[model samples]
Target: MPDTLASNPEPAETRSRASELMALHRAEKLLTVVNVWDVISARVVADVPGTAALATASHSIASSYGYDDGEQIPVDLMLEAVSRIVRATGLPVTADLEAGYGDPGETVRRAIGLGVVGCNLEDQLKPLPEAVRAVEQVVKVAEEEGVDFVLNARTDAFARGRERDPEVNLADAIERGRAFLDAGAPVVFVPGKLTDEQVQALVDAFGPQRLTLIAIPGTPPLARLEELGVARVSFGPLSQNVALTALQELVEGVQRGEGVPSSMRVLN
Candidate 1:
């Protein structure tokens, strides 16, 4: 059967509690947003005693399906992956619905049905107005559903070939960030090309209370991000790459008659 977010939807109390956990990250000292692809990874991360929450990596999901990222996967497939992840863990799972999948209102309704307490919507692939409209729809749906869904609005200006002109890129990011916030996004994620000064500037522009900064891949270390007043840090597909590298090494070692590393041996 094709996978999808549950049609029945979660109970009101469950949704509220999930939203609360997402909201609490704002005040917490550190929040590690790990990227998970499948139910196994989600379960493992959820079992981590100190993990704040879980997030899906669009690239990882797309790669898994032999496709490129950026809305390549159908909404049903994405929602199914999300549902499996939610079932694998008790913690809040943030589905990275690239470009909100389709119409904003329908996307929000479908996401909420999957029991997601948070989602990452990006403006890299869509026009600013369309992105803003989508965020607005998401906010309305979240509010009506009585779930404080954390909307992490991502601006891909820096990620999409705007590295040469720092000033222009930064300005674009700020403008997009502000638009999303105005449309009801509680967090602004500037993915890529964010320097220390740039990060601080975004924080200054948006303020810590109103907008949380989400750090993307290769941005900086968690300590530096915290120093910059970033509220949340995400590794995106880095963790998955690390996992792939480890597996490759393990396989190569075995093929070379080196045997598996003792550390990798089953505990039984």
Candidate 2:
């Protein structure tokens, strides 16, 4: 048997939250996450009646701070932003630690320290073995911290290999996803503007409730994704885009001498 202490090292509350997050992924019900960049967004989503858990969009967070994605923002700054989000709500917060910010283990340790019970660590199409090892390192760190961290191991084959044959990208995603799962991640996150057929292929390969997806344009609807057995569907940076679009339209309307929309709520 596994060492109980090594398997569960978090405080009672923290462990409970982590377990809750894990259970959300394992359930038949799809976990819908509207990724947030800051505390306000976190609070807004958490206030929603059915928001099961919270997730962070690294791209949104970086862009909010006027930095680019791909780890352009400093690690400490990202952690600080995550810390605020974690503190802003009682729900579990899963971060998108893009490629682990160069130190998968250490970054996860720090994120766990900040009350993050889960995270999305993308492979960025690295060599299969190297990416799998990174997943292992993150799982090890989470185990050491005693939290059943929901490692949404992301395979970016489709995202990065758009120029290549669809079959090649699909094969790469399946291979990396299986490797990540074998290495210890609970679910595999495949992000791209994928077709319904491609989504079905992943769900079939990973099995029901074991695959996660990002909701991009042309993606299947939530009901369809749930039917396909996708455990989770997150908006990633697109949530921020929606918010920004509203803001832009509001400003443009104001320039035309129109005031704030009467339908706006004081969410902040």
Best by TM-score: 2
TM-score of each: 0.89, 0.95
lDDT of each: 0.75, 0.90
Candidate 1 Cα deviation (angstroms), residue 218: 5.1
Q: Candidate 2: which pairs clash?
A: 9-146
Instruction: Please state the error at residue 255 of candidate 2 in Å.
Output: 1.2
Q: For residues 69-146, what per-residue lDDT tens digits would candidate 2 score against the true structure?
A: 999999999999988888777788899999998899999999888788999998998888899999999999988988
Which one wins on lDDT? Answer: 2
What are the RMSD figures for all models against the true structure?
Answer: 3.6, 5.8
lDDT of 1: 0.75
